[model samples]
Target: MKTDSRWITTPITADLLRGALDLERTEHGVLPHRLPARARAQCGDPQLAMVESQPSGVRLVFRTRATAVELDTLPTKRLYVGAPARPDGVYDLLVDGTLAGQGSVSGGTVQVVDMSTGSMELRPGPVGTLRFTGLPGRDKTVEIWLPHNETTELAELRTDAPLTVAPDPGRKVWLHHGSSISHGSDAASPTAIWPALAAALAGVELVNLGLGGSALLDPFTARAVRDTPADLISLKLGINVVNADLMRLRAFGPAVHGFLDTVREGHPTTPLLVVSPILCPMHEDTPGPTAMDLSALGAGRITFVATGDPAERASGKLTLNVVRDELSRIVAQRAAEDPHLHYLDGRALYGEADAAELPLPDGLHPDAATHRRIGERFAELAFADDGAFAGSGGERRAGGR
Candidate 1:
């Protein structure tokens, strides 16, 4: 804790947060969670537990006249045992809804995972501070977007001026769910993630439920989405399912239906969009159980390779193409009775041509440039005049310019 008398310390609370469904009071401070406690209690998956705590679209929003601000955070960074070190997660500061500055914290806890053996080891580290100074002193809305890929615990918030929770701008809330790509894998920062970028471009409040390696249409996740308040909803399905090889085609269809049913229970007429997987050559026609490219491991690079047999499609195996076909058919069939239900072929956002231009460096997640491209494309497609999310009363351009 800083002893500077000029700094005003404010206790972090739920009213200062956006995009997180729940907040867990930690030993140091509150930790934001994308999923509620009831949903977390149902699943014992370690992957879900970690990713949901990563605060994809979560941020601290308030109105203040502060010219200087400091946030104390304890971040848990993930590392693959033999792979190259991951970069430090970034914190983006926005003033009056426009990006103003960016900073990062250092010396936090580390979690090292051995991909081949599925083993994880933790290393303790100290908390770090992120500070921004010399802002315009006039009263303005300020947002501190946390890292999308790092599990962070908020310790304290201090500013040179008094701060109050910002009133809601009354934007329609968009609740989205998907895999790691949507969870912000390989993106530059929190606000640079595709969902965040798209929400900014489309002018809506984002509630990201994009769990990495865990968007397998789990009932608990569906229930969480069902309970959250939202005017628009989207599910980016299939990649995690195919890569995890969690189920067969027989189970995939029913799982998709069940997930939608759960969400519709609470939001029956909400414009719901079902998005199929984008083009990943490794899993496009080939079934997965994607594996680490062990050969690259020696070079300290991490890449993925599909291990499932292409012949397994005969046994009801699910592939990207298979999932896309199934999703289109399912959405069309359901749309007859539910006019608000919509389907988007994920390739529209990133097709083979785009993949050829900006290949997935990991054979899975998109690069930062690709993330920007996807976000821009998604906004155009989903928020356009004739798009499914259009005319939902919250489709303004970036900064409402």
Candidate 2:
């Protein structure tokens, strides 16, 4: 539906956005970026460029009395050449911190990628709008969470009534970094992602840096984490290293230590937690460079298989089990000097037993239900009375420079 001219139009400003590090003005409108321009410029990888702009944990937040709201966006939806059609990305609206409504815009830009060969083609489409109606017409907080996997360019925001920047609720800020799993892979919606859900449950503000296929302990990423402000920090490592086959055992340990050292430069006393990879049977004992299961692909399903031999471990190839053991030792050795530093086995969030009941649909990322389970488990483990993030008593700090 065309937006009513009488509806109030508001400028999409930085103050109204959360979880994004930078905002780039585009020909259409503003694009929220998880990585800063400097960090982005330093790397030439298209994967990082794409995922950082997906706005995994980013959202528009404010105080409004509008009963109806509309957001105009140009979303770049990804399509695999031979894979089944994927659903449109979801937009979740919250009123006073509770899920009130959901919407999705159709007819945006489409990016077709070939999995077998690393090639991409972009097809531009018209801008679409997401509309949410019947919100409570009283002074209340409103949050419109962008899609976790879609690259969205904000064009306009329309509301039946005026809105203002919402006041901070004095919650502690939690900054977390991880892989695609933490980035909301296969999760139902943006807010339903584990980090977002855990943050809501723990009553803390969140700045998620869960870049898909690009959390490989890069100096720029470590610098990004070093620069971002937060009361608590957590790093979920190992799976990406194992699956990407990015490095050997000798390089993995030093890379992790260096990454932590960079983060500590800015937040020396902040509660920092290091988490290992969860149970992934494919990569647990077997090494990888995981490959797409071509047999399943022909049947319109996407699945992955580890290609590296288990014997490669003797030659320094990294596996999930090897990564986990190394991470445990590294954290334990570092904790004696850094009291705020802590370690949690990632299996505690999603373990062997949980996998048997709810196996990974793609042999990798969890399904929607498992995302919820992980989020709930994370909240229980990280925010409990004696949890790693416990006793963080202070007003939430503002994130983003």
Candidate 3:
């Protein structure tokens, strides 16, 4: 019955949400005034796609019917939005027509925390719209974050500020792929996601394809990478495929080539880096498809754990070493003809030594702090030379450090 309690949808989609723009209405459906090439083809699931970047002005518009009363003080109960960059994450609250609020966002120092501590608190990230929770009676100014994906940028305006957001100008587009860790499982903020932080450090942009619970070398994802535009690209592989038992030695070889082949079509010759998995004890050396960890979620707990044998991991069945070895072979053979391809031992960024100090907080994803460390290492290794990859080979990549 109320604006906040209801929402309307139109048929419009794009690859990756990019740039800033105004919303437009079309006979076919609602369309964004402008969409970047890369963002034009992301997230095949249109069910939850944003109308545009920030919903193409109103991508995920939500409001509340709660009568206005001035916020005598900060509200206690709050909302949380995790994986802000992920398309399926549709958890934004808008007030009036402007973006009055946002989900919890993290900066370089702060971690996104929800009132529950384990969750992220959704609140105003930028100030294009105004959210009226209990503020109907007062003539007061409420603070709002800029409507667009803003970080390291700042400005201030009253609720009357025109609803125009400057597109992210520090765009350095880094395309990253990996397991849950890369999907931002434990990172502190939406923007603080490792790829994002690394991009920030290098003054580049990002196109993160880190799929949670599903980075098992899906061909569609490979095509996604092939079609997307990126200044830099990195694929953090291994753990997921090994744990998922997605492929065996015979099939894995060709699959890797196919994935690369698809990417090469679009990238042609970008700074492509292949990264192996970090340390995980359970599946380290085991050949899976393993089980899930569903102990705490009511009845579904037991089914989550993988049933694969641990011996396989300890012996030859499963191991980061095996994955790394084969992966190296793949890259080596590929590099013979292509000079731009590079490889980095996942550990070097956060190898065994660092892992010892920073054990996996969740047995998989790194903690917020580790994400920061990883981001820095990636920047150093990625940009340490003349824009080339800083790998164990000690060879400078085509791009400068």
Q: What is the C-alpha lDDT of each candidate?
A: 0.92, 0.92, 0.51
Better of 1 and 2 by lDDT: 1
TM-score of each: 0.97, 0.98, 0.60
How many clashes does the backbone of model 3 have?
67
Could you say which candidate leads in lDDT? 1
1-401 per-residue lDDT for model 2 (tens digits):
35567799899999999899999999999999999999999999999999999999999999999999989999999998789989999999999889998889899999998887878999999999898989888999999999999999999999999999988766788999999999999999999999999999998888999998888998899998999988899999989888889999999999999999999999888999999988888999999898888788888899999999999999999999899999999999999999999999999999999999999999999999999999999999999999999996665567532
Expressed as tens digits, the lDDT of each residue in 1-401 for candidate 3 is 11332322212222112322233443323333223334445545321132222211112211223333111111111222232222122123334423344443332112243322344433433212223344343232222222222221111112211122323343355667776667666565554557656866776545556655556666667776776556678898887777667666767778788889988998877878998877665555556765534343333222233457656544445456778888889999999998889888777778777788887764566877888888888888877865455332322222111
lDDT of 3 at 223: 71
The predicted structure with the larger lDDT, 2 or 3, is 2
How many clashes show up in model 2? 0
Candidate 2 clashing pairs?
none
Which candidate model has the greater TM-score, 1 or 3? 1
Which 10 consecutive residues of model 1 have the lowest summed lDDT? 392-401
lDDT of 2: 0.92
